[model samples]
Target: MKWLLQLVLTLSVTFCFTTAQNPEAAGRASSWIGGAEHEGALRALKWLEEAQDLGDGGGGWGSDAPRALLALQLSNCSWIPNAGMKAELAATKLELQIALLLWRHHEPPISPGRLAQYTLALGAMCKDPRDFHGHDLISLLLRHEPESDFEFAFVTLAVCNSGSHARKRHIRRLLDVTGDTDKHSADTLAMVVLALRCVAQEHRHRDLLRFVAPPALALAALQQADGSFGNLHTTALAMQALEGAGAIAWDRGAAMNLVLSSQAPDGSFGDTFTTTEVVLALQSRGLAQVSQCKCNKPRLPPSDTELGNFTFS
Candidate 1:
């Protein structure tokens, strides 16, 4: 209990937030353009917090526990568990989640992609995947063979966040099997760009980063005229990559519109999973950009996109 909630306030208050210089950067972006849209974002966040498994963090896998954890990290959602949920969430809730994941990992085995994503959720909140309970996230991923473009992207991001060198070989294997061409989906391209950027930062492999430019271009080309990658789930992830890299100028309006439009009157997305992702994507718009998801790492070098400039180690 004390172990978990102690860091809640510190973590909640420290996340980055920044306003877009131009509110008009995109048409509907104007909603989030004003920082969480005040009422709307909070409504969405409130819905997410309520969706938590109050007594234990094992509500569901998709966005129930880990995904919601990530969403809370990305947005300024109120992490103060409700009077009842707070005490519960701050105590055995985390432990319950760890135990469940470990149990699953041993039996059927958590999918490589889900493991990578779970690692990300933990790392985003400043938790260590190296020693979560008795499991090592990197060790888990090392044994996995990624089956999709998204899996590669998630694994790359997980490694970057943990700063683990042992998994580099595995990541390279995934990359070698993947393509950075137009054939990839926007979601896939975005993940590739993000994973490559993480590689450049963690390993200083600028050579790998150079290959990211094509996928970035491919992602830009995939955008619908409306400013979303066709749906809130994909668009939210794609926007994170584009905004984080500061590459491939995007239709801010479209991106913003997608987030704002996806929100229901209840202040939530269609469900717990999409709501979690949607909130993070919209929330990021108003937050100061970070150099990388690695908690502490050198910035990325200037991208060819010429939108946002950063430096990498």
Candidate 2:
């Protein structure tokens, strides 16, 4: 009897350890996305074990590195008991990623669009934007100016993070894009709405919504038979934007299901960068929800006084 009891105890411990290591896999069938995938994010994160130079003077090709860390952070690997990352290994990996990004500095070809994306990831993890390895990432973004629809959208997110508002020119540009039914894709239109929703005042907010409503509705109509608005990327952005805009109610079940289907068995969405983008999109948040930023808060400094002071002429 004594030997049997000891054997049982050992087996129990082994089972528990295995479960902890890959807990997300067990829950995969039930939801499109959830906290369980934080493990996958962590697992995928291992891909960036070594950060070398990004050949385009871009410092590192693994731009998704910061995002992988944020996925783990937002999922509450710590503070949420029974969560994974309790092992020393998980914490070490996180620290390593932070060090990797911060130490590397912002290299060239890091456009405002790219920098804003980085800022969101860093801010999501509670890291400082102003002090990123001696780079004021926010200030750097200002220098690039907005040309692409994506840049306007990201800058809007950056503004929300810092408690700022949209400028007249940017608002105009975004509005112009939103008006063209045939030009921008669902993702670009979603991005436009995302920016407008974050910064517009009461009346303007309503008008912005009114302007976006037609496009937003049209985008929703584009939902494929599989429930995706377009491809994995467009679908992800559209889901977040439509949900955030209050233009239409979302069937999260359907949306999540679509996203989950695209993920490969290895916890990647086809490749490294897509995996990161999907991970972020799965988190289902707009950058403007600043209060959700538990870490260093990615927005600009808290003074309305500082909102537009750094813009290019």
Best by TM-score: 1
Q: Which stretches of candidate 1 lie over 4 Å from their true place?
A: 1-40, 53-63, 76-91, 104-106, 166-180, 285-313
The whole-model lDDT of each prediction reads 0.59, 0.54
**Every model's TM-score:** 0.70, 0.63
13, model 1: CA deviation in Å?
A: 28
What's model 1's TM-score? 0.70
Model 2 global lDDT (CA atoms, 0 to 1): 0.54
Assess the local accuracy of residue 259 in candidate 2 as a C-alpha lDDT between 0 and 100: 78
lDDT score for candidate 1 against the true structure = 0.59
Error of 1 at 273 (Å): 0.7
Instruction: Report the poorest 10 consecutive residues by lDDT, candidate 2.
Output: 23-32
Please, what are the lDDT tens digits per residue for candidate 1 over residues 80-185? 2222334234323444455555655357776788777677666655557777654677667866767786776667667666655424454454355345365677
Candidate 1 backbone collisions, by pair? 17-287, 17-288, 18-286, 18-287, 18-288, 26-253, 27-253, 44-267, 227-254, 299-311
